[model samples]
Target: MEQLATFGAGCFWGVEALFAEQQGVTSTTVGYMGGHTPRVTYNDICQGDTGHAEVVQICFNDSVITYSQLLQLFWQNHNPTTPNQQGPDFGTQYRSVVFYHDQSQQQQAVEMRQTLNNMGLFKAPVITIIEAANQYHLAEDYHQQYLLKRGKASCSL
Candidate 1:
């Protein structure tokens, strides 16, 4: 079966690219989530007042890759210790978050976070938020598959 997993780990560009190349990932859409505003734009998120995090919504085949594996990728790709920031981008839009689609997903996310924390994987504590998915507004077409369009393998970050 196909499942959904939404993650905000730094910029969506590289994040989306990473997952899109994965074995199980069927599709990926870059978007905004966990925000109050309706139909938020890239400019609005950049303004830093929309309460939205730039996110990538991934669709994957559960038989090929488990949600736990996706969580591991999310944790490994970016520093979850820093709040409201990633790499050179400093803002709420770049915050690390996991938007769970079901109770099972929620539980898995929480447990995985705790396990990583207990393992002391990071010098600072992991601060990635695990919450119910909010409205996901797709980013502008120009932002979708941006790295691919530019013939780049990853974001400069």
Candidate 2:
């Protein structure tokens, strides 16, 4: 069956590229989520006042790749200890967050984050937040597949 997973872990460009290359991911859309603003935009998000995070909504086949595996991918890709920042990007929109689509996704995200913390993988505690999926505002057309179109695998930052 097909499932949906939404994540905000730094720049959505790299995040979308990473998932788009995954075996089971069917599609990835860069967007804004977890915000109070309605009809948000890239410009609005860039201002860092929208309370939204730059996110990628992923569609994948569960039979090919489990949600847990996707969560692992998310954890390995970005630093969760830093709040409101990822590499060169710094703002509320760059915060690490997992927007769960349902209870199953919520449980898995919480457990994986806990497991990572217990393992003491990072010097600082993981601060990635897990929240229910909120209204998603699609980014401008140019933002979608930004890296892939440029023949890049991931962000240089």
Candidate 3:
């Protein structure tokens, strides 16, 4: 099945860039997830009270990239040990999280987390949560394809 994976690993820009570069990632989007609100503005989420996380929704071809492979890439790209932060970005919105789409993913996330923890890969324990996806609010137009279009103005992180 063609599957989707949603993750919040700090700033969506860096997270989006990493997944977009992956071979099997057919499509990717910057968005907010794991929030109670149906649709929330980016500004609101930034304030840290929206209960939403800054996330990237990845659409990948399962034929080419297994979810486990994607998860591996995810672990390599971001710091899951830090709670509510990635690099300079901090707060609950930037919290490390994984929004599993189904039961298999839930199990995979748990297993992967255990493996990573057992390996002693990081100082802080992996705080990424695997929650059932609720709603995904696509980022504004200016935020879409941000790394591609704004390469000159901003660093790729």
C-alpha RMSD values across all candidates: 0.7, 0.7, 1.7
Candidate 1: 10-residue stretch with minimal lDDT: 148-157
Backbone collisions counted per model = 0, 0, 0
Clashing pairs in 3: none
lDDT for model 2, on a 0 to 1 scale?
Answer: 0.94
lDDT of 1 by residue, 48-132 (tens): 9999999999999999999999999999989999998898999999999999999999999999999989999899899999999
Clashing pairs in 2: none
TM-score of each: 0.98, 0.98, 0.94
TM-score of the candidate numbered 2? 0.98
Per-residue error at 42 for model 2, in Å? 0.5
The residue-by-residue lDDT of candidate 3 on 1-157, one tens digit each, is: 5789998888888778888888889999999988888779999998888899988899999999999998888888889988888888889998889899999999999999999999899887887888999889999988877887866433444
Alpha carbon lDDT of each predicted model: 0.94, 0.94, 0.87
Please write out the lDDT profile of model 2 over residues 10-41, one tens digit for every residue.
99999999899999999999999999977798
